[model samples]
Target: MATAGPTPFDPAAEFDRQVRTLTELGYPKLSGLAPERFAALLEPLRATALTAVAGEAAGEYDPESGRVPFVLVVTRELAPIEETMSRTTLHGGKLPGFVDRSFEPGALERFVATPEARHPGRHAYLILEVERGEEFCGSVPLDAMATIAGRGRSLLTIEEGVALITHFPQVLVKNKCFSLGGSRSGDRRVPAIWISQKAPKLGWCWEGNPHTWLGMASAGDRRATAGSSGS
Candidate 1:
């Protein structure tokens, strides 16, 4: 069977979808901001050039290749991380999302951005050049991190990973999930997302471990944006 191609890039449509999803999910309440204010907060990023680039198999993507693109990350400031995961769904929105019990309270908060991973530092922004790193499947995350950095690409954080799935849940297919090695708690645990019992799960794996089915997720770069801007 032939594989399907990457989803077409459409910053305008995606921005609208995200705004709608966030509003319907009651994001304004989560951010402690009025609906109008919340919408205003996202206005600036309307101009972000969410250009899509060619993706290579697991280990083949070039860190230097042209701009990589995907997803708008509403940082922890605007939307709580765990709550975002809980509100996410998969399988045509039928199955609800959940975090692993092994993640203690504040556990997700413990993970921070690695040097390789950069963001715009805004309440809400875009993550560009997103790649699932399927080529690194069966490779240890620590090894994958070194390789990704060596290539000048940044690893995807737990937030970025969640954002990817939130907008494109279809990416979490069986035997091809991804690890968020960029978000480290200063130990062995590597946050990841995968399909579980027909549902989506936010969990973790060992940095030094290798799973034939899991690859580390990464992106080309991140940009900070503000005010309402668009194509």
Candidate 2:
């Protein structure tokens, strides 16, 4: 055969690859923690996210293999993504670069940062997936949401932000884009989580917020979209 052309990127595979690196890196304290409690806390987040995603559409959230990957749109070019997942910070998991480390040696009964989170620093990538509505976002400023909407987009919550930080610390927010007329306004922005490379060990915070870019159009812009329903 002749020379092969380039191929498109596989989001799922690429996501898994990124996650694999962390797993390989290893969470020093993962083995020591109570698997039951850790699994229990994680389950609720997964359930709620899955339910919210499923309520909107099928295949939005995947639980088959526990990949739990989300789309991360980069509003800006190569926004810094996190690489480490730390426990709670001084302000309750609201600090940069995994500052207030909390391995919680015996606090398994309560909750402490995993050893994996104690890592010094990591690289990150800012990714984005099209979101549905304003169900996940509770911390985002209400006024900001309205202003952004006027620019041809809407604001959603960063549900995955916590999980992303807790696990990968690479992604920022689990945001969404409005399907109404397929927003294509160049000025529109959507916050997203970034994959990391050599960034600091930024534990978790609301600063990594990303914005959507080039508009959120599926087929065309400013046009009504229709779908068929079951009989």
Candidate 3:
């Protein structure tokens, strides 16, 4: 018998994967709706279409041109940051996610989108072209922000960060995590995702600080078509 060829990359399958992930993670309950209802909210987005981005790895692709790597991001409108963070998993689901005490109530809400990183404000959507920013490892978040902006890229938002790890837990590996620079609380805290004790963590770092294991995550664009019934 002949060996089977490699599986083709399918955007529709990828979209289904994201929808299934969310439903299995109890996103519907968190969104105060039934699982079927929540899934319905996302079904229309499948028709939004995708421009396939080709890349074998995170840092190998060009962030400035062509279609870059992308991720399906369900925004904060569906779930608060703390709830979303707790839902994220890693280490094969052996560890619970954490939200540092320093965050306090409403602290995360203060982290609004930067002028350069405006999003569609949809409940769920695709982060059209994203980068984990492994190439910026050891670079300060603030400095990396400048470079990302200069290159016309937007930083990843807190919700987007959670969504990335939720769907692609493997991306939160040691020595190659990423910061959510697109969302800022107007001080120095830059929300980031890193491996902690072999489990995924939702934590923060000083914008001016640099860590050998951390880099600033960015995106080429955010795309969400308005649902016929409104977002």
Q: Write the per-residue lDDT of candidate 2 for residues 1-231, one digit (tens) a residue.
A: 352333333444434443443334332233233534433322323232333234334333432212233422211111112223343122123554332233223221222212211111121222233333323233233344444456543222222233333443322322332111211122222323222333223222232242341112111011011121100
lDDT score, candidate 3, position 231? 9
Candidate 1 structure quality by residue, lDDT tens digits, 1-231:
554444454566667887877788788899999999998888766665333322321223222221235567888877878788887787366777889888998898888877566466658777766888888889988899889888887888888888888766767777778899878888889999988868889999988889998987887767655332211
Q: Model 3: which ten-residue window has the lowest total lDDT?
A: 57-66
Q: Model-by-model lDDT, in order? A: 0.74, 0.28, 0.75
lDDT of 3: 0.75
Model 3 residue 67 CA deviation (Å) reads: 11
- What are the runs in model 3 whose C-alpha is more than 4 Å off? 1-7, 51-68, 226-231
lDDT of 3 by residue, 96-116 (tens): 677777788878778877776
Cα RMSD to native, each candidate? Answer: 5.6, 15.5, 5.6
Worst 10 residues of 2 by lDDT: 217-226
lDDT of 3 at 225: 63
Give model 2's clash tally.
35
Off by more than 4 A, model 2: 1-32, 56-197, 200-231
Best by TM-score: 3
